[model samples]
Target: MDELVLDGNAAAGALAEIYGDDMTTVLAECASCGRVDPIGGLVAFVHAPGIVLRCTACATVMIRIVQTPSRTRIDVRAKRIPPPPETAR
Candidate 1:
């Protein structure tokens, strides 16, 4: 059976709760595809035990966030990308 897929925004609440920031705006680089995008651009699978965020370009797993009774576990495999420098206007 096929699982329902969602946009990364679906995990925003959980991510914000754990990060205490709007993580969706964070830039991430996909290890497999070398594509850089905001966390909100990734594909999300939320029906599993935890939230799985994948690269939109290659569908590679980027971040996995799991919440347990004892502790919250986060596995971040994606590289953080720095924003481009702004040019003088």
Candidate 2:
């Protein structure tokens, strides 16, 4: 709940740690399978500014990041569903 700029993947418990200055891990439980993904590997989509990120595991959309012309944080949130874990890959 630190409120750092993060991707939708980060919201799904896929990220292990905040891996960069631009991102943070937003931890939450999966609504579907109830598995803990730690928001790992897939957070790259969230952390990447202006670039859309998809789940590396399930190839489903995680979230979208919009950056200013200067590439600043615009908005962030979870979507309809979280992606499956990498094991699903």
User: Which pairs clash (backbone N, Cα, C closer than 3 Å) in model 1?
Assistant: none
- State how far residue 43 of model 2 sits from its true place (Å): 5.5
lDDT by residue (16-58, candidate 1, tens digit) is 7667577888989998989988888889999999899999888
Stretches of candidate 1 exceeding 4 Å from the true structure = 1-3, 81-89
What pairs collide in candidate 2? Answer: 7-46, 13-37, 13-38, 13-39, 14-38, 14-39, 14-40, 15-38, 15-39, 15-40
RMSD of every candidate to native, in Å, equals 8.1, 12.2
- Candidate 2 at 5: error in angstroms? 19
Give model 2's TM-score versus the native structure: 0.34
Q: Number of the top candidate by lDDT? A: 1
The 0-to-1 C-alpha lDDT of every candidate, in the order given, reads 0.79, 0.37
* Candidate 2: tens digits of C-alpha lDDT, residues 2-75: 24434444433322221233233434333333333333344344434454444444444444444454433322
The clash count for each model shown is 0, 10
Model 1's TM-score against the true structure: 0.82
How accurate locally is residue 72 in candidate 1, as Cα lDDT from 0 to 100?
A: 64
